[model samples]
Target: MTQDRPIVIGAGLAGLMTALHLAPMPVLVLARAPLGEAAASAWAQGGVAAAVGPDDDPARHLQDTLAAGDGLCDAAIAARILGAAPDTIAALLRRGVAFDRAGDGRFALGLEAAHSRHRILHAAGDGTGAEIMRALIAAVRRTPSITVLEHTEARRLLVEDGRIRGVLVAGPHGAMTLPAGRVVLASGGIGGLFAHTTNPPQAWGQGLLLAARAGAALADLEFVQFHPTALATGTDPLPLISEAVRGEGALLIDETGSRFLADSPGAELGPRDVVARGIFRHLAAGHQVFLDARQALGDRFAKRFPAIAAACRDAGLDPATQPIPVTPAAHFHMGGVAVDAVGRSSVAGLWACGETASTGLHGANRLASNSLLEAATCACWVAGDVAATPAVRLRPLAEGRLPPLPDPAVVRPILWRHVGLLRDAEGLRAALRALLPLAAGGGPASDPATLGLMLAVAALRREESRGAHARSDFPTHGAGRARRLTLNLAEAMQAAAGLADPVVLRA
Candidate 1:
């Protein structure tokens, strides 16, 4: 079903948007499973944030994004993406995305943390990501120019002569080399690497690893955004009780029925990192924390957030009657393969967007619901750039064997114990040491194991506390500045080897 153009390595929002924009050029969209199955985009409960509300403006949105980013967001990139919000929203509508609307036909906007205005556009209650994915998948399926290969996994990027040729895929039809003139990596984030996460099990940072292994520069790999209120139901990968629930008037309380976070600067409305830390401290003190929605919200709670309601029911609780137990869980990665204003990675002819690409908009901490906004805007930008570029001849696919996959059970505990919400010099060093053996046992240095090692190394290199990456030993935030780092297998190995006694250097 394919001929030319690039192979999109995922069927998520970014991948579909990239393929749709490159229409008539023949795109092969690879999905590990059927649509809405393995993609994290479908699991998102919060809606995309944009300056779509009547009272909102792009400049205000940009400023909010920058402030939340803590001096790490690229101003030009943020401005460009924010400026395109209305058009991207319109484009989604054109593709049949059913955003919630008021009785008067105006878009219904909801507020989240750090947003000065109500600009969140939702769908069918709290299933904004699912709704957006449904619309995008339908549109992509209807596009004759794009071909979707389901139950297929991209083994590695096919790079030849410093250019991305295609990808090696393994599917029902066995291994095959799918060659294309260009390649777009819309693969999601690295949420699966942690023991507690809100992302689907398949989101193991494969896209980030693939690009990094191929010599693409990665930025801000250390900063991982942990959502503050995942339901503490002992689920292997925790279920998120979205921040939207709090926006609807839910309060964070301890077992004594005391409002714990009320005194915090933003209280129930604080930034994600601050809120996550507050919850973590409560748990550390052996106190049970819960989200109290019954008093203020009552029956309307379940109606507003059905996902949280179902989770509470599954855990033998009722949000309308009792407080729902909650904890911090890995929700979003703010870092990944580095990219520019147009979503172009360090490697030419290769592009990334969404959670897989670190565009610096999220910074050390991501403002709630800003993820969907970033994905939509960046995907649109990448698509336009790809369409404008002249078609080049497809480089012959390279012949290389992929390293075996790493065990999640081992990785989960290491990340959860050491690199979770709070980190320190000793714990991070130990994490590096522990992960090194796992990496060595996997296979050749050219494998995903090595890529995982690179991520760990990157996490170890950043010494000072900032955003989601808090180090008790180096508790103070470094001089407010952002730096980008790119590591290959050798560099990563060197850094990892030195982790036995890490040199705590600040930026």
Candidate 2:
């Protein structure tokens, strides 16, 4: 590959879509795992949210998205992304994505939590992500200008004079540097930092760590969205029972068969944070929470949600015959390397899309099913930005020592205990203390610890309860208008050392 060819990290939707959109413009894609595995994109069950329904439009979708974001959404960015949703969906169809269609030839749109319209586009029932991946992966394979490196993980981005010179990657062949002037970090979320999460274990915030170490500004590191209904069968990374099930009328019930969330606003259809907290509190109260799909879907459950049904049957339970055991698990992160309108990060020649980039569309909380839309839609903008930017002269990269492979095991417990659904200053400070040394060290836990430390500092700084970040000690919204927060490694470390105020960059 030439130095001018852009390198895309991660083989998921965002990375793949970005590469495809840049097609005819040679690009290289690196995947830690094989193309289809270890990607949270393929695990998504809820369909893509778009304003495809006849009665719906981008304005209405934007309204619901802003409401879910809980006052921190970048309205212009949200409007741009949501407004392009229809065209983005059309582009997906052009890329061979076979979204489900009704008998009348219209797109089969399903509803999900916080969505006012039936605009969730699915394929093969609940296996939306898998279907989308199947199509996109096939498209990538067929594209002549795209080069894919499976089993290759990017260890560090080689930056010089504040510009991305190359990427140091470890692959099956061994460690080598790809001297590309342009790079994109599409690596997924930070859910793996939690002990119990719905995200793939590979999503331990590697993208955030890579960008942070390279001096990129990250935003909203405190806003972690916990999905309310991860199927709890004592699994490490629990299987997700999609919120679309509840959109289809499934109820949250306890051991006594009581609708435990009935009194909560929107109940089962509430914003993800609210429902997650409700389930978290319910479980803390010594009651087992279950999603009773039996009364709602019953025999139709298997047909509508084949993937979830198979997961339940694998656990020796039937969704049709019984209530499915459920619990709150870290599902998504609304924080990452902050990007501008065109997906350009603070670092020159580096761009981010998908969950890895905090594009401000998700804000404090992400509306359900909007992740796919964001990843798909923003890929075009990122690609256009990358394509238009003049390629820089490739600098001679030094053979820097490879950082020890990251292990998230040590960081998971600290986050789950202190930084999970509910947080307090004491616990957040304790997390900072425990993570500071590991983050500063050059050991196997450094990367994950660094990410955790950043999150803990952000959480401690934000005193009020807002969106996914609920401070138990301060249970109400802060005064005045809500502002989004941004932090870098220096600021986070300074705050951790108590040498500076933790007031991060607010925008």
Candidate 3:
């Protein structure tokens, strides 16, 4: 009910970083679960990508990012984020985060698929995300002006006139209003909407839905990056075998133990989309797929990647002795509630960062570790911008359209089957037919369904193979420059229902 302190939803890397950057100024942070455990940021294993090496710098990082984006990246945005990475890394180090280092005192880096150099800074081998989040969480907890509300879910935005006033959240005692002038949507991606994903199963694109309902512009909905090597256990939110495993000289093989990636353009170090599709073709043909890292890592697996080693042990697989069964699982989303360079959205008083905000840095395909750096740099930019906005009086609106939420069990499988790694016109159309009904507002499935429908619709339109959005129907790039689409919930829904194109809707 105040304007002096802002409210931040989703206590992930973006939210926590935003809160920390706005120090001395009071802020409210809300999370659906405990801070550290709920965020996909904590699940990042590849580490932050920065140009800290002697032969590497931001220009090279930007070039590699552009190359990986498959010509869909915003050159300006890529330069901005990748350029600031060294400073961001420095800031994290100052916050007491430990990064793996070589004996000569240089930061030890790893090579992931698509990056041109070993510029990724890791912590605790492959536990990079966990380490960064642990440090940020501790720093946030120590900040006196930051008030974190654990187990709090922001369900609605309280908008009056044309500006957002605050958020309506569900707590243990039920729904309550948290009034503020500026509210930031730092919610993570739509990974949970898929049956198999490297992200937490609870990440149901709630931020995308919340922002869309509030009339924010969303872009690149078709681009969802699938990590090529998630542990193929029958677990929800499948455990990830870090790409670093491949960086350490692992090879992808079929059930017959034949190395397949050698046929691709990037080979073992190709872009994520290529690797994922390579594995998928074999999987679709009834061949078992495995990640053959045993020869490369050998007995050093446990010492090099403790977290992955523990996951392997827990799943009844020994990494040092045998190949790990793997499959492509939904990982980072390249699209989201589209945000400006400084993190502002189409809706005033609201901003988004991290995976929830499609800031054009990732474009069609995000470079490894850029997600964490974007979260840090953009959060700071947003904090600075939010500081300048004049406070507005709170005007809470009446509750409306509160509907039963859809079960994840029903939504996840359908999306994974139709819109997973590879897609075609028929599958996308079928997906729209099934998902549009559930996304029809007034249910828990509304958000996930809406986001899924948007992606499927866009995927259908972009009938060509471009970056992560591969369509079997359209195999070629077909010439011309790549165009970016920005749509709201209604426009996206219209396209999903075969009523109108987003271009016509915008017109």
Candidate 4:
């Protein structure tokens, strides 16, 4: 479909904000499901983290962010993002977002894991993500310049002459090509690549795959962030008992009614990667793990964390009376299509924001609640950049040629078994061996799974442990100073093949 406009993939906060900033330009937003249905942005419980409180400052927020990133965070990017917080907050407020307020009408902020101060802004108790999305969606809906096509999945980027022209999308209607002056990818994270995740099933790293296949540079693919405490009710892929629950005094305990985190330094407030690994170790040792909130929050626990409470009740447990079972799950990817501070990807005419792009703000691990802030700030920056550039009509491409999409069932087990939280050389090599044939078979390749494999391949190449990518065999950090990596499918595949079959590991 030829149109004089821009096409944005995914209708989460980032996409919507990008469209809003590029207002008056006809824009089409492709959504795989209805707004608030498929997007993970609405699933966020903790509010956006910014230095909005009097006691907090942008420099302090930047320091906390870099500290949590585990020595890999870019100082300049962290500071730039931190400094943009006030304007981001202002823009959200202008869009009618109703942040929680104190008795004196100041914004009421809350704290989460790894923060040095109370700078997280909340809304409706625990519905901050949904609330922010609701407001943004409303603004998009009212803007005549924006058109949202629901139930539409962006199959691939339509790259012509080394620049993005538009995308091929599969919707309920059928596969169709939508041409635009520019393309923005905000297709969320790689959570769905695992057996368990807090993000929705749609967040399967499709954006990363699409960019990789289209020759876009990717960064930090090895650093997948696993949240420490997803509720373990035996639900398919597990449900998130938000970090806010712990922020409200819930305690993590092993099966023997023993508080495990309490004995660790920082207790429930430890960094997520540390806590997740601790819980995983405990489980491997044959001990069960649970989150105890009954003693601290009592009946208020239910009202405070309704989603968690409901999930517990559905699983036949009462959080007010007993501890809730928990586990670590693949939660976020700190690396994705590498982008500059202005959100422009390596490919000209293409931009990415949100979890889909690795802007280097979230280094080895993400600071809690900083995600929403990144989405808003980066989207705004992209919009401004897009607006400042002179518009050029995109030429039509040879139609009907679409890139392959990978099968989820085929890639899921490989990722879960080999590239999971506790990965070693043996498992990663096995995973690479298993995936090679699938990649070669030439079936519709999944963008997300391909991106996941690229990450695993990168992790395998490193041969040493660092931050979120811990390898038991190489238990120490490598000598190479931390630097970003970007690889194409062929380069990554070659690297994967060179690895010895199940690379032997030493204890």
- Provide backbone clash counts, one per model: 0, 0, 3, 8
lDDT of 2 by residue, 226-285 (tens): 999999999989999999999999999999999988999999999999999999998999
Model 3 lDDT at residue 114: 82
lDDT at position 71, candidate 3: 85
Off by over 4 Å in 4: 1-4, 402-406, 444-448, 501-507
RMSD versus native structure for model 3: 2.0
Per-model lDDT: 0.81, 0.92, 0.85, 0.82
Give the TM-scores of the predictions, in the order they appear. Answer: 0.95, 0.98, 0.96, 0.95
In candidate 4, position 396 carries an lDDT of 66
**For candidate 4, which ten residues in a row score worst on lDDT?**
498-507
Identify the candidate with maximal TM-score: 2
Error of 2 at 490 (Å): 0.6
Model 3, 1-507: lDDT tens digits are 445479888888899999999887888999989889879999989989999999998999999999999889999988998998989998999887999999998899888878888999999898888998999999998999999999888877766666787787787777777777698899899888898898987797888878888888889888999999999998887999988899999988887888877877978778888888888888989999988878998999999999999999999999899999999999999999888899999998988888999999988888877888899888989988887787776655454443344356677888899988888877877888888888785576776787788777777767577888987877778466386767777777777766333343222
Clashing pairs in 3: 405-444, 406-444, 406-445
What is the overall TM-score of model 1 with all chains considered together?
0.95
Q: So what's the TM-score on candidate 3?
A: 0.96
Q: Assess candidate 4 and give its TM-score to the true structure.
A: 0.95
